[model samples]
Structures are given as C-alpha cells and as structure tokens.
Target: MTKWSYDTNGTPGLDSVHAHALVCVTFSVYILAQVLRRQVRVTGLVVTKFFMIHVMNLAMLKLEAGVWGLVFMTCTLLYFYETLPVRYLPVQEKVVLITGCDRGIGHNLAKQLDQLGFYVYAGCLQKGSEGEQELVRNCSSRLTTLQLDVCQLEQVENAVNKVTNELGNKELWGIVNNAGICFVGNVETMTTADIQKLITVNYLGPVNICKAFFPLLRKGKGRLVNISSNAGLAPVPEMGVYCASKAALATMTEVWRYELQKWGIKVATIIPSGYKTGILAYDKQATAERWWRSASDAVKEDYGKECFYAKPKTEALLSPDLSPILDALVDALLSKSPKAYYYRGIFSRALPFLYLHLPTTLGDLVMKVIGDWFISKPLALQKSSKKF
Candidate 1:
C-alpha cells in the first residue's frame, strides 16, 4: 500500500488513503447538512443559526478534513440534544400520594419525594410496621403516613377523603399506585381463591384507586403512575397468576391514558424487571410445598411430587439499587412530557422488544430454550433419564 501524503494546506497530496478519507469526510458533511436543515424546519430559528455557524466553520477549515468531520459530528449531536428528556416541573407546590410505602420502592420513593420538597402521603398496609416507622423517623412534617389497603374499596375511599381534607384547596399533584403482591405457582396448582387474591390486590386495586382519585388528578391536571412488572410483558411458568394480574394492570393503564387525556391527566405505567423487594423475599420452597400439597390427587399424580418439590437454582437477578425505578416514577410524576410506559431493570426493554417483534415460532423457540436453561428439570426425571 502506498503511504498517505498531505500538503502544507492539509489537502491530499498523493495516495488512496488520503483520497478515501477526504471522500468519507465530504459524504459525512453532506449528510450532516441535510439532517441539520430538516431539524431547522422543526426547531425553527435556533437550529438554523447553529447549523449556519457550523457550516461557516466547516468552510473555513476545508483543508483540514478531520476538523470538518468533527464539526459535522458536533452539529449532528446538537440536532439530538433538543430531544433529551430534561424538563422538570417544580415539586415544592405539589402533593403526591404513594401506595405500598411499607417497604421497597414505595418506601424509598416516598422519602425521596418528600426530600425533594413535595408533600408526600405515604400509604402503608400496616400503620405501625417497621418500614412505616422508619419512614416516619426519617421524613419531615411534609411526609404523612396513611393506613391504606388498596384492595379495600372503603379504605381507598377513606384515604381519598383524608387526602382531600388535608389538601383543602391544594390539588393532589399525582398518585403512585405501587401496591401489589405476587403468588408463584403453576396454574394447575393455584386455587380459584389464589387467583382472585392476586387479581384483587394487583389489578383491581389500581383500578379502584384511579377511579376514586380521578377528580383530584383532574383538578391538578396531574399524573397517574402504575407500577407493573416485567412478568406482565412476558409470562414465566410458575408465576402465572402474578403475571396475569400485572398484564391486566398494564392494559388497564393504557385504556385509562386514552380516556384521561381529554381531562389533561397523564397516565404512565412503569414495568420494572425483578428488584430486591419484599415481594420476592418469600420462602419459595415452602410456598411450592404448600402448592404441591393443595394440588388435587390426580394433578399430583400427573406431575410427580419430586417435580413439584425440586427447587430450581435461581440466581440472584434482583437489582440491589432501586434508583432506576424511582427515577422513572419521579419522571412520570414531574417531567413536562413523560413517556406512556417506562421499563427498568435487566432485559426489561429487550425481552419485550423480542416478544413483540420476533416471528411467533422464533419467539416460542427462544422462550423454550430460556426455560430449559433457567428452570431446573425434575430431579426424578433427571436421575431416570440421565438428561436435563
């Protein structure tokens, strides 16, 4: 290969390398100019002025192709800069109500919002619970703890009334429907009552809360943030009821968004991947044993006891830090323009994309492969067949 050469003016003297670099830089600048011009149409005079300044700089540095490329790249960066989600409204004058503040995300978020100057109504199932006590100990007068059980319509209505009384003339800026529960067992193992409880707490709870708080939200032109799960987007075998409940809530949120938009109330759903929360901090083996024992004799016979008893080797996939989810919730409540849906945690966004975009057969195959790898096979079957 011939060595590249450049003249004192920085123009290509001889060699294909110099020529190729010049061509690449020229092509990049042309694309950048077209993009900037289109952006100018949308962004108006500001982008036009910025684009013209870069164009002038590029012309002045024509001999220095590298400088030209850098200038073009900077313009492209500026084009996207305007799209960043950076707008935030004042929280000091706002009042936000958060359910499930006994622990986990709700507890942390209530404290955070209170610190950020919003008057926070921290709703807990047990008024004197450890989590509630800790919140009271740390939070200032701005944070008020309320005994709220979303599943109880009377309690929800009473909580609404209490908030209304507290607010008086001030509007309720937002409501974070964070209360939920999970029951992990196969569909065959789950009883009718189990399913009902899951749906009642996870799905209908948010629905009831939203219906009761619509007037407050409308008055403030505020937000409705529902905390869903990654399981809602895609099912896991043993978590059928939990997944179904979350899926229902996610769908309900979408419908409510459309209906509530006319009243200037924003509805947002946060579908988070597994995080280290009290929800998952349960005795899986004990729960599985109960499920196995409760299952019908015929069902037990069909699926062997060893199969039901064998615990899968579940890796610790829960995120320790809850900031990503908390940040998303804050954005939903306080951002000038919030997204309809916010997905957090590992594979939260990617798995949904694959499920929605992949071919049906391919998606099914991928799920089967994932189940085989992650879900342990029955110990008895493995011993008999010498295969997993």
Candidate 2:
C-alpha cells in the first residue's frame, strides 16, 4: 500500500516500488533475532515470522483500503490456520450432517456451525430432546434436526434422504462423525456388551455414516471429520473400551485419508482430549457414583467399599471445558486442506506429539506420571498389573 507509485490500480502495488510492502518486509528482519532472544527453535521462529509478516502486510493494506482489507486479512488468516476436506470437492450453500447432536461436543459443534452460516443438518438419537431442541431453536434458519441412531442404518438413510430432498441433488459437505461414549474399568471386569457398545457407537458408527454419505460427499468433494480422542493415542486407565474405539478410529482416518485423497475428498481426524460436556458430566460423577454403588455391592466380599470408592486413584478427573475443543473441531471442519490429524486441547499438543516422538518406555513413564498425578489420590490402580 506504499501509496505506491503503481499508478494503475490507485493502490500501492505489492512489488519493488512499494515502500509499504518494504516496510512490511522489513518487520521480518528482526523476527529471527527476536526468536533467538526467546530461545525458540528456528522452525517455530520461521512459522511465527511468516504469520507476523502476513499480518503486517495485511494491516498496511487495510490502512490503504477501506475496512474490507482488515476483514479480508482476518478471514484469510483463519482460512490458512485450518484445513478442511473439500478442495477438489467443492460445494456451494452445502449442507453438513452431524451425528450425536443431542448433547455434549456434538451439540456444541452443531450450534457453532449453524451460526457460522452453513446449512447444518443435525442427527440426534431422540427428537425434541431438550438440548437438541434448544440448539435447533437457536440455530433457526440454518439448522435442521433429524432423529438418528447411528447404529441403525435405516435411521441414517432417512436423515440422508431428508437432506437430499432439501438439497435436491446438491453437493453435500459429508458428515461430522462426533457422537461417542466412554466407560471406566479394568479390562478383566469389562463386559463384552460394554466393549461392543463402545465399538458400535464410536467406531462402526462413523464408518456407517461415511459409507452412506460418500455418494453425497463425492458429489460435493466434501470432507469427513472424525472426532477422536487423545485416549486414542495414550490409553486411559479405566476407559479401556473407550481407548480401543478411538484408536480404531485413528487408524480408520489414516486409511480413509489415503483412500479418499484421490476423490478430492479429505478425511481429518481431530484427536482431542476429554472435555466437559453432557457426557463428561454424566461420566465424571457417574463414574464415581457407579464405583460407589459397585463398592457397596462388593463390600460384602473381601475387597470392601474403601478399596473401590475411597481409593485415591478415583479422586481427581482430567476433564477440561468443552468450548475450546469443540471450537477446534469446528475449525478443522471448515479448513480447506484439512490435515490427517489435528490435536485440540491444552495437554493435547504435548501428549500426542510426545507419543509419536518419545521412546516407548519414556512415553509410558511420562504417561504413568500423569496417571499417578491426575487420578484420585491413593490410586488403587497402582496395585494392578495392566498399564492401560
């Protein structure tokens, strides 16, 4: 915007003649020095400087133009900050169907996306569930709630059909496979039904949704977002079944990433940490409650109530708030070149990268320290042999 002598566009050209661009370029001169001062790695310095330089150039243009320059810059930054699965598969005024929107992270995402102006197709287990209805009501013009149980193909198809009718063969944005469940227990005591339930709802559910929606997504060149967890990376103590399901999902995302990349469709696995939502609210206290009741039930045996409920391992839970995690997932869904994996959570950044980089034993040791610190005090799990 150098008040450039471009003479043609009436705007400072982004070239050798522009002093503003030069000023913007000059900002990067000391960026490396600033990074070395902070002892940050040159790699990080490179990324930070790149973004900063873009911002500076953008700000200069904003001053040169009307407010649109700033708005465009903000939007551009956000666009690059995330990757989505719809480059080759493009959709206009497209629809996105999300599962498990009745509660928890799913509900949060449904609400956020609808507000962002996408035609949000929400699939929930039950119609008029209080939370689901609230979101539908709030989402208003952009939202549509369909009753869907992912385990049932017919229900899924019905929702798809409904969307098709509304869309009339229009391209679809695929599905955000977000619904999932959790449980806590040693694998020895874990029931087959429980394991199957986790697999059904968490693993098979996404596959089912993907299979049914691929035609639509193929048309739209859409993306599929698999909401996974860090437990998928480092297994959790009591949530053996939960961990298995997410780990299965992580592998599935990788496979889908390779398989679907050619179709102009992208599959992104958002492996985030556990967050507080309806499910966490249910699981956090209910886990302890179940332990309490089960302890009462088992008290008559040798290992009494104290061993189960009062043990230190069950005391503290690692659940963080859901807002940030949900925001990240929504962000990934909107990205134009979504990645194979995105981690979202405070601890998520370090933990999963560590899982990929650290030596197995060292990673386990770090995880073990986490296990020892985050759980209820006087962890009874310490007496056990199984690590996960």
Candidate No. with top lDDT: 1
**RMSD, every candidate, angstroms:** 8.4, 11.7
In terms of lDDT, the poorest run of 10 residues in model 1 is 38-47
Error of 2 at 196 (Å): 1.2
TM-score of 2: 0.68
Clash tally, candidates in order: 0, 14
By how many angstroms RMSD does model 1 differ from the true structure? 8.4
lDDT of 2: 0.68
* Cα distance off (Å), candidate 1, residue 319: 1.6
* Per-prediction TM-score to the true structure, in the order listed: 0.76, 0.68
lDDT of 1 by residue, 66-183 (tens): 5445456556556544443444787767999999999999999999998899999999999999999999999999899998999888898899999999897689999999988876
> What is the C-alpha local distance difference test score of each model?
0.78, 0.68
CA displacement after TM-score superposition, residue 223 of candidate 2 (Å): 0.9
